[model samples]
Target: MKQSKVKWTKSVGWLLFLMAIGFFCLQIGYLIIQPRYQVEYIDNRIFYVINMLSIICLYMALLFLLTWKKIWTVVVTTMVTLFIIVNVVLLVERNKEVKNISSISPNLQQIFAIKQDTETGEAMYYRSYYGILSRPKDRLEPEIAGDYKIEWLANDIAAFTYEAEDQTIQQFIGTYGDRQEDSMSYYYVASQIRGKWGADNAQVERQNNGIAITVDDQTELFGWDNVEQFGTLAIVLKKNNEAVWAISLDENFVANSEEIEPTVGNISLYKATMEENDPIVLAYQGGAF
Candidate 1:
C-alpha cells in the first residue's frame, strides 16, 4: 500500500508538471506572435489570473517532485511573483493608453465601436453583427483622429463625420447591408435622391431605407417601399397607401447631365393632397444626391 501511494504521488506530480510546461510554452508563443497581430481577450484580468495560477502550479509540482527542495521553492516563488506583478502593470498601462467608444444601431442588430489610442490620438473603428453571440468585430476605419459624430442613414448604414488632424472635415460610411438589396428596381432613382435637401425651415433626407421630411420640428418617414419614381423628373412619397408628398425635379435637369453635379439640383416639394399650395424649392446640401 505504501508503494502504491508513492506511485500515485509520482503520477500526479508528473501530470501537473506537464500541464505547467504546456502553459509556459503557450505564453512564449503568445509573446512571439503578439507584435505581428492584434490579440484580443474577452476578459483581460481573467487571462492574467489564469497565467499566474499556472505558474503557481508549476512551483507546487516542482516541490512535490523534488521532495520540498528549498532552492526550487524560493526561485520558482520569486519568478511567479514577478510574473504576476509585471502582468498587472502591463494591464493597467494598456487600459490607460486605450479608450473605447461604442454605439448600438437603432434597430439593435449591429454595434459599432471605436478603439482610440489616447497617447497617439489614433482611432480605429469596428462593427459587429449582433446574434446569440456577436461575431468577431470587423475593422472599418483603420486610422482616424478627433471626435466622431455618428448618424444612422438607415438601420444598417452609419455615417461617421469627424475633423481630421489637418482640421478638414471628413466622413466615412459604414454600410452593413447591400445597397442593391434595399433599392432594387429604382436603384438609379434612389441613388440620385439619396441626400439632404433644404428649403428654409423644411428639410428632406432620402436614406437607404426611407425618406425623412422635417418641417418646423415635425418629421415624417416614408419607407423606400412606399416611394414611387416617375423617371428622373419626379417622386411621390406614400404613407398608408396614400400619397403624402411629391417632389418634382427641374425641367432642364437631365439624368446624364455632365454640366450638373450629382449633388447639385433644384427640386420642388408639394403636399400631394393640396397641389394648389405653393411648392417649396430645395437645394442640395450634402450626401450622394
Candidate 2:
C-alpha cells in the first residue's frame, strides 16, 4: 500500500511539471505573435503580478517533484489555486476590453490593422476615406517653428494650420476614429499611420494640391454602400495652403458642408476648440496628442 501511494504521488508531480512547462511555452508563443498587446495603460503593475505568480507556480512545481512531504504538496496545491484565481480575473478583464473593441463595425476594424517595420519598429496603419487611402507621415514630433495652434473642434476631432519658413501654409485636420474607451496614445496612432500610404504613390489633387492615394472600388472594402459613416481618419493637406480646408462629414452632414467639422466617437463631439497658446510646448507633451 505504501509503495502504491508513493508511485501515485510521483505521477501527479510529473504531471504538474509538464503543466508548468506548457504554461511557459504558451506565454512565449503569445509574446512572439503579439508584442503590441503587452502595452498596458494602467501601468505595468498587473503585468508584474502575473510574472510573479508564474514564477511561484514554477517553483512550486519543482518542489512537488523534489519532495513528497505532505506540507510541500499542500503548498503546491495552494499556489496552483491562487494562480488559477488570478488568471480568471485577468481573463475576465481582457474579455471586457475585447467587447468594447467589438463595438466598432467590421468595416472600420479592417482599417486599423497595423503593420510594423521589423527593423525600425515603426508602424503603418491606414484607412480608406472616400476613394483615397489617407495616412500620416512619420513626423509625429510636430515642429513648432513659429506661431501655430491646434484647436479641438470636438472631443475627438482637431484642426491646425501653420505656415512653414518657405512661405508654404500647411493645414492638417484629423479625427479620432477608434472608440474613445480604446483609443491609444496619439503617438501610437501616428506611428501606425506613418508609412502605409507613402507620399510617393499619392498624387496631389489639382483642386486643392492635397495628396490622395486612390483605389478602385472593392466589395470587401468597408463603406462600399455607405461611405460616410465608415470614415475612420481623414486629413486634407493643401499645397501652399490655397484656401484649403478639409472637413470630415458623416450622415449628419453633406460632403463639403461648410458648417461641418471632423467628427469622432459615438457621442456627439462638443463644438469647442481649445487653442494652445504656446505651440512649442507641445514637443514636451509626449505622445498624448
Candidate 3:
C-alpha cells in the first residue's frame, strides 16, 4: 500500500511537469514567431495568467517528486512568485497604454483593428484572418490618428475614414480577397458586372444584391433573385418569372485578359422579347469587379 501511494504521487508529479514543459515551449515558440509575424491573442491578459499558473504547477511538481531542503524550497517559491507578480504588473501597464478599435468584415472572415497609443496619440492598423486559434496579424502602413469610421464597400472590402494629425480627413482601404482574380464561385457574372455603367441618357448600377436601371427620369430595380446568367457573355433579368431585360457583354471585350482592366468593359442592354428596340451600349465607369 505504501509503495503504491508513492508511485501514484510520482505519476501525478510527472504529469504536471510535462504540462508545465508544454506551456513553456508554447510561450517560447510564440516569442520566436512574434517578430516575424504578429499573432492576435483572444485574451492577452489570460495568456499571461495561464503562464503564471503553469509556473505554480511546476513548483508543486518539484515538491511532490523530490525531497528538497526547506530553505531552498522557500527561496525558489518566493522567486517564482515575484517573477509572476512582476510580469502581471508589466502586462497590465502595457495594455493600459493602448486603445483598440476593431471592426469585422461583412463575411465575418476577417478582422481589422486600430491600436492607438494613449500617451503619444500614435496609431497603427492591423488585419487578421479570423480563425479558431491565434491568427496571424498583418500590420499595415500609413500611421493615423483621431476617431475612425468604417464602411463596408463590399463583402470583403472595407473603407476606413479618419482625421489625420494635420486635421485632414484621410481614407484607407482594406481589401481581404484577391482583387485581380475571381475567387468566388456563384457570383462570377454579378461580381464582374458590379459598378456604374452609362449609355446615351441612361445609367445602370449593378450591386451585390440587385441592379438599378435608370432611363430618362425613371429608375427600376432588378433584384438578384430575378436575375439569371446565360453562359459567360449574357445575363437576363426577369419579372414575375418572365424575362424582361437581357444584358450581354460586347463581343470585342475579352474576359480574363490581363491587359484589360476587369472593371473596364462594354456591355449592351435591350428588351429580352423584342428585338425592335436598338440595344443600348453602356461603358463601365467605375466599381469593384
Q: Say which candidate scores most in TM-score.
A: 3
Off by over 4 Å in 1: 1-8, 35-53, 70-72, 99-114, 121-289
- Per-residue CA lDDT of model 1 for 1-289, tens digit only, reads 9999888878888888888888777667666654655453322343565587677778777766777567866877788789889888877776677765555678887655566677877766554432211233434333455555665444554545555565444444454543222233433445565578888988888876798998887999989897766433456676755556666554332343221455445666655431124467788787653
The full ranking of all candidates by lDDT, starting with the best, is 3, 1, 2
lDDT of 3: 0.64
TM-score of 3: 0.43
Tens-place lDDT digits, model 2, residues 3-88 = 89888877877776776676676556545644543322122123434555566666666765685578867877787778777776
Worst 10 residues of 1 by lDDT: 129-138
What is the C-alpha lDDT profile of model 3 across 133-244, one tens digit per residue? Answer: 2443434233455555665444454545565566444445454543233433333455566678888787778876798888786888999898766435556676765556
Off by over 4 Å in 3: 38-47, 100-114, 122-289
TM-score of each: 0.38, 0.25, 0.43
Model 3: lowest-lDDT 10 consecutive positions: 132-141
Positional deviation of residue 288's Cα in model 1 after best superposition, in angstroms: 26
Model 2 spans with C-alpha error above 4 angstroms: 1-5, 36-78, 100-289
